[model samples]
Target: MTALERIAEWVTSNPPVTAARRAAATDAFVDTLACMVAGASDVSTLGAIAVASHADPRESAMCVDGAMRAPSSAALINGTAAHALDLDDNFIGAATHASAVLVPALLAAARQAGADGAALLDSYLVGLQVQREIGREIAAKHYTAGWHATSTIGQIGGAAAVAHLLGLDATRIVAAMSVAVSTASGLKWQFGTPVKPVHAGFAARSSVEAALFAQAGVAGRSDVLEGERGFAALYGAPHADWPTAPIDTSVAHAIEQPGLFPKLYPCCGSTHLAIDAVLDLLREHSFAAADVAEIVVTVLRPNAANLPYTHPENPTQARFSMQYALISALESGTVSMADFEPATVRERRTHPLLDRISVRTWSEKAERIMLDQGRTPHRVELTLTNGRKLDRQREVARGAVSEPFAPWEKRRKFTSLSGLSDAHYDAALRLAASPNIDAIERLLAAAIRLRNGAGE
Candidate 1:
């Protein structure tokens, strides 16, 4: 059977769900909802909602603001909002912002099908697994070549999840995934722009549409992912090597393994490691931002490429700017959500510390060796005005599996970003045990109003 067929079969077979997987899924949902609330007013999300409001306005699925639109339109608006701040979690296995796409798309499908919270979590795991499986074959090559995996891989995997929620059979599941391939598209070069978040919107909308089409009896080539002139052949290396046998998931699921990476900082993930490294140095030594004469950061080539802005003119570009991120961390000892505000960017842009920062990338050969050895830390070098240099390297960010945020920290982030009452947060945490998705939708709607009223 083709890999896609295997995925469809496994999803339909009702694979076992572990307690750990359920917890992870629940956390992801809460985090994504918080991000959605925090980003609801972003220009990109507003733009998507404006377009969606005019498209169908069928009032079929719930949006962040409590209004209803067609399922696909809601997915587009919600997904855009979820990812607009670049604070959404990451799945290293798939090299995608898994939750940003999956949560919005699945929420829409779940409401349409009246699926319960358990079913929604199950569908999320299924979709993330599909992305990990496909990514094993092509993510590195695809991402390094400038494709946005969040949109490309996300559309395909999210379609399978939506299909599952819609109760499509394996045959129809294959059709949904195949149709998704045609819509899978996003470029990494669009990073640092409003278009970047819209990519998630596009993927979420396409996934919902693909699944709906399949449910309507539309079909496509079953081998569209691996056939001649297909997804892999067209999107990856011509001779990209795929596994001879499917990896075993019976004993361990992807979420319990490589896991989803939650972000502690609200900036492009590529900048996190460097920021962590700088923060480490500050903890060990006593020096204000003004005392720093020079700050140099060394990272992988792809990460450096992702951070092209040395002097960002706006908040969007600041998210992708290593110089801006490091300076913010150095000066304030933390990179808060407020750090990315327009006035903050404008004020910080002229700081002399911005000029003190410079970035360098490891050579391809060096990076390859580090990858093979299984450790590729981002390095930060700090030169003080007194001519003393402090060096630090961080292999993992604070919010990664190896170094997780405390429970209080997680709660703090959710409340701070979502601006919702603790009662809403409690409701979100109990989602796995809830009978339906009604509470979640209501909480998200309240979060939107509260966050907006606070002028965030």
Candidate 2:
């Protein structure tokens, strides 16, 4: 069977979850909804999508805080919005933004099919579990070698969610899985452009199309994932021993034991550890930007070893640039939405900071220590003119596996992004904790109120 077939069969056979599991899924779904509201009005590609989506509106699924749209359009908008802040949770090992990408796609499918909140939550959790497994397996090769794990692995998550919502039999789920193979795409090379969110938009739209096609009995190659020219071989170099492991296509539970980590920072997951380390130093020691002579950051060779970023020319690229972000944090005290703008792209203040900051391979002991904790740790050393030296070592970045952001912190982030007032933020946080998608819809409407003049 194709790799896709294996996952589909598993989704079909997975048993009902306990109440606790369902509640956990509900929690994650609400977080994604908050992510959508926070990002909906971002001067991101999502806002433009919101505009374009309204052009051919259909009553399939809800937009951030507005009228219904065609299922495909709704998925696109929500997917875009969820990823708008670039602040969504990451599938840590896989490096894909888990909740933003997966939750939005699932919401679009669930709303279109008129599935209840309970069913929607179940499907969301199942889809995440499947995505995690796929990411764990595939990214050992594909993502490490440079493909964007988001598009490559996101298709499976999107497909799994649709299969659950549509009540597709194992056979049809397999069909959707195979057909989705043709739709899987996205690359790491496009990180800094408007095209990044478009990647999520396309994943959402194509999954809906794939599910509909499968519903129509459209056939596809069975082993699309394992075939000679299939996903494994074509996307990136596969791990040499992955073919030898006899994967049992029979997992019944979708939620991993601990569930996924919601993010605290708004940059590439790989950079979170370093950002956290640096921020802590600034906050703890209160380092003044003017006092620093040189800043050296120790990062994993694997994350940016082959990454050839000469200088970031845009905000999207800036998100992935450890040099740019650290530099911005040094000069600006914090990295905000404005740091991603075109005006700051090549500005002297930002660029000079980049020169002061240099990245080198982390020591073997450091790498082993951080990885053991399921987070990347960074060691930063800054030399000051007054003969003062500051050293900061972080085992994990903030908003990640270690040093996570709290609920209130996330709400503040949403309030800033969506321009929601304190009252609206409180309500949205409640929506995040609730199971009602309508409450989420209400939160979104309030978000739109904040979007009027906040042009991306």
Candidate 3:
């Protein structure tokens, strides 16, 4: 069978995921919801809502404005909101923002189909696994080729999730996957722009539409992902390594290996390791931001390429600027969402630090080591005016699988973003464990109300 067929079978097999994996999926869902709430007020999100509303007058629940929109429109708006601040969870291997795409698509399909929570979780897990596998097959070549995996790979994954939620058979799921491949599109060049989050929005909405169309008997080539002139050959390297066999999720799921990296700061994941390394140094010594004469950060070549901005003039650019992220963390002892605001990025105090900070590219050998270890490697050096220097290298950023966030930290993030009462917070956690998605929908609706300042 073709690779696409094998993937379809795997997705439809309903492989058993461990309770730990399920819990991790739940955490990812909750974290993405928090990010959605935090970014609800962003202009990019508002613009997306406006666009989606115009295209489709039908209404569903939008997490941002508490306005009902069409199911696909809701997916577009919610997905855009989830990624507006670049704070969504990322899968390192795929180099894709998995939850940002999957959650919006799956939530839209589930609500439309009246799917329960367990089904939602299952479909999400399956979609994440598919995305990782596809990402692994394409390797870094696809991303390095300037294709944004969050939209390209994520479209197929979103289709799988929606197909699973709708209980499509293997053949129909294959059709959905095939149809999704044609809809996949995004460019890395759009990074640092509102178009970046719009990529996630397009991926989510298009994938849902693809699945729904397929389910309605729209025919598509089942081998669209692996045939000649297919997804890999067209979007990735012509000679890229495609998976030869079907993956067994029952043996090991993607959520349990090379897992999701939840962001503690609202910036690009590429800058996270450097921020952590700098914060660690600050904790070890007694020196103010002014004490440092120079800060040098060395990161993998891919990371260096991702962070092209040294002196950012806006929040969008600041999120991708290694210099900005590192210096802000040092100056404030923490890089909160507020640090990425225009006022903070343009503050006079940050200009001096931005001048002192330099980001360098790591050696090719270090990049190889990072690929082998599945880590985001970064080396930090702070040179004090007194001529003393402190240096440290971090292989993994905090909040990665190796160093997961504590329950309290997750709760704090949720409460801070949603501004909901403790009762609502507890209800969200309960929804995670419950089999009822109606409860989940209600919880999200309440969050939307709070975000829009309607229920206060």
Candidate 2, 52-83: lDDT as tens digits = 55555456677775767777777777877777
What is the per-residue lDDT of model 3 for residues 273-292, given as tens digits with 9 covering 90 to 100?
A: 88888889889997888788
Candidate 2 least-lDDT 10 residues: 240-249
Off by over 4 Å in 3: 55-63, 432-435, 452-456
Stretches of candidate 2 above 4 Å error?
16-20, 41-58, 65-67, 237-259, 305-311, 341-351, 362-375, 387-389, 421-436, 453-456
lDDT of 1 by residue, 1-456 (tens): 876787888889888898778988999999999998888889999999889876464567888766788999999999999999999998878889999999999988886788998889989999999889888778877887888999999989999999999999999999999999999999989999999999999999988999999999998888887788988889874566655465467897878767888998999998999898888888889788888999888998778888989999999999999999999898789999889878889898788977778889888888878866756589998999999999988887888878878889888889988887778888898888888988887887676666657422
Please estimate how well model 2 matches the true structure, expressed as its whole-model Cα lDDT: 0.67
Residue 341, model 3, lDDT: 67
Candidate 3 backbone collisions, by pair: 58-70, 59-68, 59-69, 60-68, 60-69
- lDDT, model 1, position 308: 88
Q: What order do you get sorting by lDDT, best first?
A: 1, 3, 2
Ranking of all predicted structures according to TM-score, beginning with the best and ending with the worst: 1, 3, 2
Model 1: per-residue Cα lDDT at residue 393: 86
Clashes of each: 0, 5, 5
Instruction: Assess every candidate by TM-score.
Output: 0.96, 0.84, 0.95
For TM-score, the strongest prediction is: 1
- Clashes counted in candidate 1 amount to 0
Better of 2 and 3 by TM-score: 3
